[model samples]
Target chain A: MSSWQIIQQSLPLFEKGFVLTLWLSFIGIIGSIIVGLICSLLKYFRVPILSKIAVIYVEVSRNTPLLVQLFFLYYAFPVLGFKLNAELCGIVGLIFLGGSYMAEGFSGGFDGVSKTQVETGKAIGLSQLQLARYVVFPQGLILSVPALAANMIFLIKETSIFTVIAIPEMTNTALDLIGMYYRSNEYLLMLVIGYALILIPLSLILTILEKRVRYGSFGN
Target chain B: MAHSGINVLFEGRNLIRLFGGLWTTVEIAGVALILGLLLGIVLGVLRTFPNRLLRLVLRLYLEFFRITPTVVLLFLFYYILPRQLGVNLPANQMAMLAFALWTSAEMSDIVRGALISVPKHQRESGMAIGLNRWQLYRYVLIPQAVSLELPATVNLVTRVIKTTSVLMLISVMDVINVGQQVVEANNQKFPTGVFWVYGMIFVMYFAIDYPLSWWAKRLDKKRLERANG
Candidate 1:
């Protein structure tokens, strides 16, 4: 069969997979950022016991792959009475991996704010809220923009690993097609196109965002 | 729903199988890293070619790699590319090729950055000493670039290691592949076998990752000290 013919035959299944990939990546990125924010804040504030827990969490998550974490959650947890759906497992796994990554970035951003600057704000009698509002937040956000962009792209690409657990995302869709119809080349081409459709725009938008954040900044 | 003991991880020949699988993962990543870095250095130097067409082709190669997920690349190489050419390679070799290609793209970019960062004056100095093009790169440019790029390169090593997990998706019998088989064999006896087995592999990955990351940090620290102190 012609490659075009194979792609044409696979369109409907591929569409379902493509949409799921987008949706999963979107939720995973957002959820990871939120989780990262909370965890980094805990460490930034030096919250008593939770900060220690946060450190361990970050280290563990940082050291492991998202694929294994998904396996642990989806396959292992069922034995322990937590039989969550595959999509749920994927999201949690993404957040687990991406959050620690972002926490590290966020904390690094938080740290990138100089200490003497904070002291200078204090000496000037800047209110606590005002100090954080005017000083820490903006700088942290600026410092964080590049890392956040990288993390977002990394998380999005990682959604492809969902094929193992049969999440029916783009990668899984291609795998299924190959299994059923043996059209490896055509369906694989479609899969790559499917991802390029998402990632190219994301990368461009991120570059623009980074430029905006970095523009007019005197010192990096 | 009972949580199985760690003994679930120790049952049968699971540990040996896992260790063997871990060895395969490292071998694949190691082959990719070594070959990729070697070729990447050549490509990096070539990346500065005066030819606009060559530069454009290189740029497209990088952009393609950057956007396409590695899994798709794996699929393309393993299931499609060689088949199209009517050549056959073992599954692991195909995995290695996919990873090496990805690593080369990344390392070439790094090498290009490092090479460019060596500054125009240094190249001028090399020419002032009557060094040929090959001699200049061989003695001065590459050595400096290697040192400058070491830490980032080491971090990339860790990435290559972690990414080998996807070898399982291709059914390459890597660490995760063994872990799955072990888990399946124990599914009847160890209800929580998934947790037990994967948790063990998690540690194994960390065991490999932790030291490399530490080494990278140390290199960064030494580089900083040499610059400042």
Candidate 2:
């Protein structure tokens, strides 16, 4: 069969895999943000041992490879009596890896908030939680917009690694097509372009958002 | 009962074997860093080329690599490039080429940012002092850019080290691949050696990367101090 015919036949398979990839990325983006925000808050408040644990978590996660993390969860964890399937492992690994970077971003954003603004919030009879929710979080979010966007993009690209562990994401789907149809050139070309189509727009949107955030001047 | 798998880490030659894998990781990362830095310098210069066409082409190259996942790029170089070009480049070399391409894009940004951030008066001073273009770059521009680039470049080195682990996908016998092999070999004897083997690999990478990141932070602090003072 010709390359075009092969792609046509494989379209449904690719679409299924593409949807899985999107779902994984979506969960990764939201889950990592939540994890990152909590860690950042703990570090920001210096909550004693929890703060230190957060520091270690961020450091170890940042320092090591995401692939190692995935392998540890998918392969090694069974040995430790806590087994997650390959897909869950991939999502968990992405969240853990992305959260470390995002935690740094969040903490940096919180730090960028003026000391006087925080003090005034306390002075105005606001509880710490209220201050964080109403005053600090919004400003921190604005300051962290660029980092958050970059982290999300990084997480999306990272979903590609799922292929290695037999999680049927887009990359795995493409690999399977190539193996089945012997259309290595066409399949690889299509995969690269497919990823570029999704990724390029995300990056471009990041660039535009960064510029807007810089000009918005809320953190200042 | 839960975490006993860690015991196999210190049992025999496993630790030593992991360290050997670490060495392979370093070799891949080291070769890629040097080549990528060289390629980056060229791309950086081209990024600010006087010719608009060259700049546009370089921008596309930069964007294409930046957006594509490193693993995909690795696959392309490993499988497709040799077939297309009719050359039989080995996987290790293709791995290096892939890394060079990816890292070059990042490094170019660092170089371009450092170069552009040089004060305009400094460039004027170089021209006023009658230095030619090459001399200006060599003496005036690079000296300043080096200071700005050093910390970021150090951070990039750590990132490259972490990224080299991906080469395991292509069956490159880097640290991760080696550790996986050892784990598979010991599968029958230890049965639960996966945690020990992979854990050891993690610690080895952490040992290498943590100090580098700490040192990068120090360089960043020093750079900030120099800028402020």
Candidate 3:
């Protein structure tokens, strides 16, 4: 079959998979941001036992591949009675993996706020929470934008692994088409374009945001 | 679920099988890293040239790999090579090819960064001493660049090792695949065997990779300290 013909036939299937990929990447990145912020704050504040757990969790997630973690969550968690569907497992796994990397980014940013800045905030009659909110967070966030951008891209790319656990994301859809098409390579091209479509624009936006963050446009 | 699948791990030669899988993972990643470093040196050096066209082309190559997921590349080569060129290679070779392609792009960027980071005066000094272009790179620029890029390269190696785990999808029989195999063989007797098998796989990866990451951080710190002084 001609490549264009195959694409025409495959577009519907690809669209279905693309929506799933978008959903997974969306939820995963948002959850990672929330989880990462909480963990980094805990570790930054030296939150006793919770800080230590956060540290270990970061180490474990950073070192292990997400594919294996997904396997653990999907195949094994049923035994523990926390059985999750494939899409849920994909979100949980991405957050589990992306959150630590994001935490590291956030922690780096927090540290980049400089000790002097923290002291200056303290000197202004600001409590720790107020200081964190008023002084440290903005500058730290500027420093972290690049790291957070990388983490976002990394997490998005990782959704490709969802196919392995049978979540039917973009890559999964392509793989299914390839299996049926008998050595045809057309769907593979679509899959790559599908990813570039998302990642390139996202990266461009993040670069703009990184620059905007420098000017204190936190709303972006 | 206390001690859920611990016994499933020690059952017979399962540990040995897991070890064998680890060996395969290491072997492929080792080969890819070495080949990637070599290829990257060539491309990276090319990227540093003053030619606009050359730099543009290299940038496109780098971004192509960067933007596309490596898992996609893995499947691309695995499928295309045999289908298009009739070059019929095995799964392991395809994994290595895909990984080497991806990491070489990463390494080349590191190389370009390291090369440019060498101060302009060093090049002038080499030129004043009547050193040719090749000799300047060989004698002065390379030595400094090597030390400058080492920490980043180590981190890249760590990334390659971790990312290579995706090979299980291509049926490369790496450690994770072996873990699944072990889990399958014993799943009936131990319903939670998948848990322990995969948990152990995670630990095995952490055990090897954490040290490398730590070493990279130390190297990075030392490099920063040297730069500060």
Best by DockQ: 2
Clashes of each: 0, 0, 0
Per-residue alpha-carbon lDDT of candidate 3 for residues B60-176, written as tens digits (9 for 90 to 100): 999899888878989888888998989888899888888988889989999999999999999899999999989988999889999899988998998899998899989999999
Candidate 2 on B125-155: residue-level lDDT in tens? 9999999988888899889998999888998
RMSD of each: 2.7, 3.0, 3.1
Per-model TM-score, in order, reads: 0.91, 0.91, 0.92
Worst 10 residues of 3 chain A by lDDT: A211-220
lDDT of 2 by residue, A1-220 (tens): 7878877877788778878988999998998999998999899778999999999999999999898899889998887689898888988999999889899889867766766678889999999789989778888778888778878888888899888799998889888877777778877877887787788888888889888877754535
TM-score of chain A of each: 0.94, 0.87, 0.93
DockQ category of candidate 1: medium
After superposition, the stretches of candidate 2 with alpha carbons farther than 4 Å from their true spots are: A112-140, A218-220, B1-16, B225-229
Task: Judging by TM-score against the true structure, name the best candidate.
Answer: 3
Deviating ranges (above 4 Å) for candidate 1: A113-132, B1-4, B119-131, B221-229
Instruction: Please give me the DockQ of candidate 2 compared with the native complex.
Output: 0.75
Off by over 4 Å in 3: A113-135, A214-220, B1-4
